[model samples]
Target: MVTSQSTESRPSLDYEAVIGLEVHAQLETESKMFCSCSSGYVNSPPNTHVCPVCLGMPGVLPVINRKAIEYTIMTGLALNCTIAEQTKFDRKNYPYPDLMKGYQISQFDQPLCSQGWLTIQVDGVDRKIRLNRVHLEEDTARLVHKDGPDGERYSQVDVNRSGTALMEVVGEPDLRSAEEARLYLVKLRTILQYLGVSTGNMEEGSFRCDANISIRPVGSQDLNTKVEVKNMNSFRAVYRALNYELERQIRALNEGERIVQETRGWVEAKGITVSQRSKEYANDYRFFPEPDLPPMVIDRAWVKEIRDRLPELPDARLARFISQYGLAPNDAVVLVNSKPMADFFEECVALTGDSPKVEPGQRARAVGTWMLGDFSKLLNAQGMEIRESKVSAEALSEMLGLIDNKTLSGKMAKGVFEEMFDTGKSPGRIVKEKGLLQMTDSTEISGAVAQALESNPDAVSDFLSGKEQALTFLVGQVMKATRGRANPAMVNSLLRKQLESRK
Candidate 1:
């Protein structure tokens, strides 16, 4: 929370806000957490993917999915958490229509991972946001509200999402602003995607976030009454929600209104948070150990094996992109943001051989430029991802090679690349088929220069009068005559020679 500075005659008001996020990331396991039902329930028919165990039928024992546990460990390790030597499940008792099991089987006192921290940079300054715990739990069913005939409101249950392997990452209340919170979520999503654990798609509800926000006096260490904000399905929504909450709290305090502890849902359509219910404390959930599950001991060797297999994370890869490829830090950041984009860049560089004729660093820069420039532009315009594009790394590298060796003009290469992007044709074949080969012949350029000098006497006179821009106009005319196939450097030299010879 922040307060407006007041005049010296008036009392100055200032405050600080504490924000913590509990993010639930659905694990990319094929089966549900405690059942064998298919986890691929997106767009599926209602209740089509449920099982007796997931539906809370009696007399069925639950068996945990091993892959889900491995994913949890991988996620925890990636976030710099310490794995517990012993962990087990607890029954979190809460009666909700969405929860099939009257109670949710989640970790309570002993979670799988604890004491982790994630680093996020804001305004070029890095901050380490600590993690309180990372625990595993099962997702509940989805409720769909519908409007019936005569304008009656009805509710439907969709158990297809029930029993999915959902893992929670609880962060400490260290975030100061909405921007910081957004960065934290973005970095966390990147790590999860890099580890190949979760898709991190919020639109489909695969990744969800709940924010705990409170505001206190600027220097006070005592915690203030906090509000839990939910229904923020996207990163933008989360930022907006927190900002709205901050302003709301400040306004309340200024008007002598008390900030009540409650649960609120972000009405995205309205761009405001509306109160939903009184906030539930820990005692409201009545947590106890699950009698059906057994506590298991985690061996040190197993944890070490997972640690050894962790992939090179985003921060490390960004550094390598700068040092190994000689890329600027800004370019490196854009390239390494997405794993696919980073992979595509490396593949293109590998295809451009390290021959004495061409420097690898130059090639890397070329590939990065195209990727961040025209390639990105076309992808955005067409609403397609790099992985979904028709152009392959081999084809793009080949196109760059053509421009490097003067086989194609830079302008011609752009057209050839566009064709390759659309038709998946080889750059060589496209250039050949379109007759777009660079015109480096001095004779052809000499004729175009003569035509331009004769046609634009004003520009030629201007050049002779020491107007340097006149020379550029002559070169543009020559390039246009050749349909942009003429080498620009050759055009410039030829145009200058003809003009100077006349003078």
Candidate 2:
């Protein structure tokens, strides 16, 4: 419970927020964690995918999914976690309607992975957020609350999600701000996606997060009472919830109020956190070794094999993009954040090939600029991913080639790109159909420059009177008169010679 105090004047103290995140990523497996039921229950009817084992029927034994275990270990290895040699399952005893078996089989003392750290950058400063453990657990069923027609509320249990393999990555309290927490989650999701172990879709509940946050005075070594926030389904929601909780705690402390240790639910509509229940501890769960399952030892050779199969992750790809392609660090970061986008960038660069007219670095930068600029804008406007766009990497590479050859001016290329994006047409077809080829003929450009000079005499006079920026205005008039078809260098050269003749 959170209590509010009187708004009395008190000395403001600088405080820092301590945040630790517990992220649960549903493993991508064909079957359930401890059952033979289908894990692809997202679009299936409620309880249709469940079996006797998942339904908690009596006289049933649960079997471990070897693929799930391998996936967990793969994730641990990717996170740089040390794999545990010996690990076993324990029954977490709790009385909840969502728990079909009245207990959850999870790791306790020894987890599958431990003592890992993830690096996240904020404001160009890198901070390593340590991991307490990356363990495996079984997810419980979902509870759907609804209002009855008779003005009563009831809940329905959807057991389709029961028995799913869930990998929990618990972080140490190394995050200091909401931005850092968001970055940490984003980075973790990217890694999971790269590994192909999970979808990492927060909207679909494949990935979930619960944040434990507390505020302490700056330079303090002691811990304070922390509040756990839940029900944030998106990265933006998580960032906002943490920020609200941090400010709430700081305000409460400043007003001579105490922060209570409790579980809070983030009401995104209200933009506030409401009390849920008292925070539960391990003792409350009464966790103990399950008699039904046997203890097993993880083999070192298997761990090494899983590590060997790991894919090139985000950080590695980012570095390679910078070193091999000569991209700016910031640009590389944006491209590498999304694996598909990064792949698209590389594909375009590869298709660009070795051309004497354009340097490799210049070609890379051009691809990066288009992908990050107009391509990104149109994709975002239509709520589409890079892979979903009509424009292919080959198409973009061809468009860039046209720009290098001066067949299309920069402005004309943009118009061609927009049409290509909308209609899936090639740049060559668009340019030919629309007559957008650059007017590189010096005679035609010189005539257009003369027309612009005749139409905007004040601008011409301004340029003649030593106003250097007046030439830029005159250049724009010529481009507009030519429908952006004139080669900019030709326009500039013709305008400068014509202006010098007038002088």
Candidate 3:
């Protein structure tokens, strides 16, 4: 197995890490879900994308966007849900400034999809998590709270986000570890991306999740009071927040403090959860029927159409990696995590032509190392993706060509590859330009070895006296004399020969 390195080991805590996620994705539709206004509210001025219908003006009507409905169905299908052919929206009546119509058009009793499951790898083992439901709803408008006259607080509303289409996916509390929670999110985002349902960009508010985390004693049957965590942006944030909250809850239980069911905000700076509002009850949000909208009627034929258009998901790709490329479990996990990187590897494999230099399995390992190490370092520094990188798969294969043929030392090939990454030029061009090609010729390296032998007579004697480590010291000297251009393997081999010939 390919070993993935991280700073911290899995925690051996006394309690279990129980987590459930509620992901909200803003649908990328051309128009608002309920009105004929633009749905792309982000980056626009306040109230710009609003309309009379979205503003809840009297005597206005609402209509559903066909594309938004299709996307929602597609998302439901990808999540492996059974689409309810005849789904309708109920008004979640909550009087707030964000709700211009005093209610949100949401699916409650009749959701679009139900009873789905997604499989994620946890600690090298695949585990399945059931999806409770995927529902469609109209987004609430933005609220700006500020100080007003008479020392009272007032709320200003922006209707831009109002009526924007939103799809919510609720996961069962099948997650039992921090890593499982992370894998679940990655798998969920992958499905969304493949369906083209949402951008899955947490920073842009297009894709976001609220995690419900509660911990109990290991093997305990009683469920602890759950705390809802909000304001987590990235997958790492979800993982870390759950981890920290799990510890805090365990400590509280051990100290005999009763855990309360409440909503909390993630303090990313402090890596902890802070108290927010008390968790709302069902009765708190008074429910009613929207008078302006009509119930939606879907059919089996439409759900089947959406299922037929489902895209390949992460588990499918991971299986392909293992069966076709013979990649180990860890290797497959890393590659499948980044779609662009996986696509790059596929392109390069196709370009290798007949009679590849190595077997498919070995080549997959090589590609994984390159992508995980050198390529990853550069990408992390530049903040770029494999798809946007200047270097192509063909270029990387050419660099591998030099290394496999012993023309470029691993150290020298590192230099060539770095230059190739920056310049997007061929490996040969970089080697020729910088003279980094391996000096494997016996004459040149031997001459440098001879100089090292002369400069360190005691080291040569130590090697002759069977000090194996001393031979490495002499090789270091020779490598320095050659300005790091010496082929390390050849130098080691020749050093053994010369020292053996002595005494």
Candidate 4:
């Protein structure tokens, strides 16, 4: 594995940064990878979900789930990988309590997918990262430990997670920064959302990653003794782990200490990678062909169908939003990050031209703003998914339409949106029920403006005396007098008319 060496000369070892990531995503299939047991048996009485196949009991055989295979192939194509025509399961022998069968069923030597690439925006620059392989494997059981005060400790095993299909995507050592890793994950997770594969929820332990970080010279072509980081549960944790490992390796090399080639666990709270044990070799796993299951041969027609089924992915969608809707890159990223958000935005467009403020172009911008800005907060506070959200596209459009039609102030419309989300009622019903019709009529607005001028002669005098912002204060008072239902645009118009009359 010899390659070109680093050219940056320094007093110490010229170390550069190198990272490769292995992500394990739990497939959204109904059953476990190799058995008929349910995959959603979380929090059940530990071993209740276990069956003969998952328990490694004798006289029971495991069967391959076709959905898992399709999911693996779909994920492979999403990574821009060349799916292997022939693939199989291999036994990775180990003696851990979590591995009930005395070995873990995984892919080795010939995995299902390989040579894929993932492109991500790192620090506003698009970087294309290479993928080594994405393979299908079975997850092991849970290993929990309980201890008492007097050092009395016991170990317990739960087989519920056993046989759960997992896809381990191995990235090439092309990532240079922690930001790059996080961006790559965002891109990868978005694709999974489009594919309807994994939930990509790191909090649920469904999607997890391990980062391998090492440092070499700035211009180094040769790699370093990379250390694998485990137990990172989220994208933020992955970024933190790589940042910590890079600094740690730099200090070690600065002091002339060697970094051990081994696996380390990410201490998220402490923000460091703790050395776990000596490196486990490939031979230690004792790779062998699975005795029960046979090899998988992917057909051209099936592959063609999967390729055809892929939706217009995130990057492409983001570009379209930019070009078509004239949204900023950041706004486009936020919208396309979640499927429902993008769908909700489009639905709003169908209801109210495009943007909220203007007929079409401005309306899209307005909708994007509210959906990303205030509405996002409202949804988060209610702990509601956009699809499950009580606020319908029609309701939001009606609310924005009121504002666009000059029938409601922006502030009044916000109040309407809040009411709409809360009661699942249309904005008109809430407005009519609360008597919040905006005072946009000239007669009503003129009467309120005259009252404000007489009530605050000094404020009118201040406006005439050249303190122009005093007019803003006067207009605000008019709005307050009208119980916030008065249109600000009308208030400004009438206030200025009265103020100019005073002069």
Each model's lDDT comes to 0.90, 0.92, 0.81, 0.85
Off by over 4 Å in 4: 1-16, 149-151, 279-283, 353-358, 381-384
- Give the TM-score comparing model 4 with the true structure, all chains together: 0.93
lDDT tens digits, residue span 398-453, model 2: 99999999999889999999999999999999999988889999999989999999
- All predictions: root-mean-square deviation over Cα? 2.2, 2.8, 5.4, 3.7
Ten residues in sequence with the least summed lDDT for candidate 4: 1-10
Task: Please provide TM-scores, in order, for all candidate models, with all chains considered together.
Answer: 0.94, 0.94, 0.86, 0.93
Per residue, candidate 1 scores C-alpha lDDT tens digits across 287-393 of 99999988868788988898899898988998999999999988998888788899999999999877577889989998999999999999999978899999999
lDDT (Cα) of model 3: 0.81
Top-lDDT structure, candidate number:
2
> Where is the poorest 10-residue window by lDDT in model 2?
1-10
**How many clashes in each candidate?**
1, 0, 0, 11
lDDT score, candidate 2, position 88:
90
lDDT of 4 by residue, 258-308 (tens): 988888899988887899866454448779999888888899899999999
* Candidate 3: Cα lDDT at 157: 85
The TM-score of candidate 1 is 0.94
The CA lDDT at 27 in model 1 is: 95
lDDT tens digits by residue: candidate 3, 254-336: 55578888888999999989998653554466666666667778878877877787777777888998898887877777787
